[model samples]
Target: MSADAVRYLVMPNPYLSDGVLDVRAVQPADIEAIRQWRNAQMDVLRQTAPISPEQQERYFAEHVWPQITSLEPSQVLVALERAGVLIGYGGLVHISWSNRRAEVSFLLTPELEKNTDELIALFSRFLDLMKQLAFEDLGLRRLCTETFEHRTRHVATLEASGFRCEGRLREHVLIDGKPTDSFTHGLLAVEWKNGQ
Candidate 1:
């Protein structure tokens, strides 16, 4: 791929408002930073397996950095920063060209905002990016996300941001050794545009 195509994978979405919050593509230097934050953050365990420094280092060194080029079409890694400090991160993963779908995931570095204002802003920018990626780039039909059913805060945010509850998975994941139910949410290109 040319530099232009590689650049597109990490480009910041123009729809995102610029200010204390800024989003950009993840770089080589950011790998360690993200790994450290992911390991320390309690909420991270809710989604993925508990991570260790060794695992993080090995994964990036072996898989990510080597074929960083290949990661473009399927995975877009974004870093969220506030005043030069990384406070959160989010991106679309496992982009399926045939199915026209992808999974959205994010993590806030705790102690960022007192209210959901930051979250609202975050999701607003995220959905805008998704719309652009789906409708303009990939011609995708929908995007999917999963959240704990009892996570009313997140669910409310998704609803406010135009995602609809599609279904539920019973005891889908085990967090802190406890089985947790999750709700699957989705947004179609048309629905997202209409909401805007």
Candidate 2:
């Protein structure tokens, strides 16, 4: 789709106004900062290890670019302040055209994670935007996400955003030498309310 057409298709960021933050499409320039944030968040992000700069660059070249080149299947986005500081980075991936569903993922910087109250509010707004992108912009019917069982805060965030725990894998993920269960959550299009 053309830029103007996409502009018409996307909605305004619900989180931004009166000095609040905004969520925007991720750009090439944002990669290094995003990499730093992602690596810092590895532990809370589950079964993940810190990535080297080379690996991070390769990931964008091999994984991120292909997705954006064909936006039909997926897109990556970032949430940031007008100052150009990255607050969080994530987006939908693993889209199934036949099933009209996609897997959603996101992470906040370690600093943002420390402010629980603000983090919840910021995440709630971010979730609203993700739903708009899925159901409206992408014509998708359902969205799903997964996290390690011990991530109570994130699991609760998903729940509060109307995602239900639909599946669980027992000892499916190895984290810090311990076998940890993973929970899969889902939210149907019918269950979403725009700007609500």
User: What's the lDDT for all of these models?
Assistant: 0.66, 0.71
- Local error of candidate 2 at residue 32 (angstroms): 1.1
Q: What TM-score does structure 2 among the candidates reach?
A: 0.81
Clashing pairs in 2: none
Per-residue lDDT tens digits of candidate 2, residues 1-196? Answer: 1252212113343233234656665666677888888777675564277878888789877866556445353444544553556677776767787898988878777788788887888777677777877887677899999888877878899999899999999998777788889999999998885425
Error of 2 at 105 (Å): 0.8
Those runs of model 1 whose alpha carbons end farther than 4 Å from true positions after fitting are 1-20, 42-49, 113-115
- The C-alpha TM-scores of every prediction are 0.78, 0.81
For candidate 2, what is the total of clashing residue pairs?
A: 0
The clash count of every prediction, one per candidate, is: 0, 0
